[model samples]
Target: MDTYSTATLYINGKWVEADRGASFEVTDPSSGQVIGVAADAGTAETERAIAAASDAFPNWRAQNAYTRAAALLRMHELMLERSEDLALLMSLEQGKPLRAARNEIRYAADFLIWFAEEAKRIYGSTIPSSRTNQRLTVLRQPIGVVAGITPWNYPVSMITRKVAPAIAAGCSIVVKPAEQTPLCARAVFDIFDEADLPPGVVNLITTSRPSEVGDAFLRSRAIRKLTFTGSTAVGKMLASRASESMKRVSLELGGHAPFIVFDDADVEHAAKGAALAKYLNTGQACISPNRIYVQRGSIGRFVNVLTDRARRLRPGSGVDESSTIGPLIDMTAVTKMEQQVADAVGKGAQVAIGGERLREDGLDGGNFFAPTVLTGVSPAMSIYNEETFGPIAPVIAFDTEDEVVAMANDTEYGLASYVYTKDLARAVRVSEALRFGIVGINDINPTAAAAPFGGLGESGVGREGGAQGIDEYLDVKLVAHVLGDAVD
Candidate 1:
């Protein structure tokens, strides 16, 4: 792979070093080597970026929807033109397989395309007035400058999901990309610059000082909205702080998704789906299945097929062509996987296949864990109670439909859940019963550029993908017109 470097803050359409010349090294989690350095932004830079966005908001909001849509379309073209490079860069920094990285680039670019069309579709409505001499109308307008805080898991996609909609809605934004993956954010901004977006319309600030920057965002009155994608703890803290200013907020937080396989489901098909849902991106996604429930009658066959699929996964560096699963983000992730497995085993959960980290081959220096399947996982085990953000799938057996649905909805975090069944009535019943923001009926991949992606409960608030996505960056105003005013 070629060495890539993008170590600067992008503010007001220019790439500049941090104010104090502070920098932080970015390491490849797969190889434990410093890939590049990113500018370490502070409170001052964050404030400046916020100010820039605020200054540019009115003109951006004043532009016709078609003009903004054209810019987004150009960005979409640039992203696709550099798809391979973006994929390689993401793979090098974030440690996902090159193939998966390529897919993410496509997914990221699709957001720009989707929102480009959606920009022109921001429709308003006219309502009948109660009084005879009055008319009523509803208008959707830009919510002004926005602040986006994205995570490292899906670096490219997360940024586009937030920024594309904001831009499409005619709002200027200041983005704070995750410290672990600032290059991807910088790369996206490069596309924006090449697309000829106006100065101050989009700003990027790479920072090691998250809280300082976040506090600056909260304190800035010019920022009207704040959107975030990260852990639940961090989301809650930011939400609490933003409350002081009553800022509009949207968050996509942690999830403990449940994958259910009923007896009526095709055992082989269910197992394949389970493997894909559980181990994609090495199970680092927020929507990854944490607890898998199989009907008592199909548990044996499901376990056999699932274990075979797990054993076939080739864990290696993300850039390696033959690798199927890549390393976890860092040592902390490895430690969490270790602790979860130890707790499950201590509580009498039996490991069906792999139960340890993969220290063999060239994976010792990086954070690599074996794809594991635990058969006897129960409520007593910590794996059942906590979110396992690694490649560990714990299978729990249930006999009744009510039991499975209850078990699936037991968690406080309700982001996503999956149900597999051939019976139409049962599928509908179970799908309606699951208390999640998104439900997959015999489908592991339910999210797309046109769907509403968000969560219920502690999983966070607001939607990110569909028509509702643009609404997050907009404000509704009801206008009442009198006959006398119309005459004048």
Candidate 2:
């Protein structure tokens, strides 16, 4: 089987090669060797993409909801048909297990399906008015072209999460998928093209240089909204630049999520869920539980079970059937994680379970890290305030529920938090008190396209998914008139 080296950027309903037509070397994370190079974007190429998307906006916004929904439905179908290919591409660049990648592909498709149905639900309200024969109505209108800058993690789903809602709201989009994992985004964009989307309604650019594409979009007066999912530092930089044009910004940034296990919790179930949450995608998830703050009594018991489960995980190349945890993206993440681990260990944290990088010789050159568990993490440690973004879960014990809640809310991030209490009354109280965007009680898979997803404070500004998603890409308009007379 041939591996793809370069992927073309799609713009104005056409696949385009860069003017310089440069290339980049994409390495296989498992092997830390160059696997292939996709199309590399220079300044000129990025400008062309922006221009293509800018030119398409007027006509795209003119499209009715039905027309837009049909295209989305078509794109959704094609996504299903080529799931295998896209999944392989995702695994190649993203370093997730092929099955996990395939699952992500399916999850990505669900957004299109959901928003396709949601398009019909775009409705407005008529305002109640005094004065005889006077009428007033408020209509939600599309907000021109949206620039979607997605990170490498969950590339396909992130793209779908933004694009589906934008398109369903009758707005066109330009997606700047991460240069590392551009193939999946390109594949989805291909489905949109094959679905017969009007030219400029959807475009894509793959670039190793985020600055090149970012500068192009920032300088352009045509792009109306900038939606980004990445680090808080970068997101802030982009937000500052986008502010020059006063562009509407939607940001989903970093998270240092916490999992609170109360004394009354189901220890076994909570531990399993925490294992899945922390180890999913090797803990690359923004919402993955990084800090496990257990009630003091339950702490010892929790780690015993958690350690037992963590030891049994399969770690190897993403394609391996026996593998449960997969590699970090590459040496960069490994190095960063290693440094953070060292820092935490230096700050007096104890290595309770798995730690250290896996030897490639044993696993046929795969980049695998053993699932690591640490305990006694102090609040001052880097691992507490910063998101490690790796296959590491640290356990910290708290004395009381209030103390646990205070500790969880102490961080600047509020993307996600988990509570394992079974008491419904206690659950409601703690859930509301967590100060995070989403909360789960005795659950792990709390992510749903139906619910609004985002956080407060530094985590992000606007919400994504659910009915509120369209609101981020829309401008509300109110009209008032007197039916019986010019002046009522």
Query: After superposition, which runs of candidate 2 have C-alpha atoms over 4 Å from their true positions?
Result: 1-3, 360-366
- Give candidate 1's error at residue 382 in angstroms: 1.3
User: Which residue pairs show collisions in model 2?
Assistant: 5-37, 6-38, 30-367, 314-324
Q: Residues 370-417, candidate 2, lDDT per residue (tens digit)?
A: 789999988878888888899989899899878888999998898999
lDDT of 1 by residue, 384-425 (tens): 988888999999999999999999999989999999999999
Number of the top lDDT candidate: 1
lDDT of 1 at 250: 100
Candidate 1, residue 139: Cα displacement in angstroms equals 0.4
Can you give the TM-score per candidate against the true fold? Answer: 0.98, 0.97
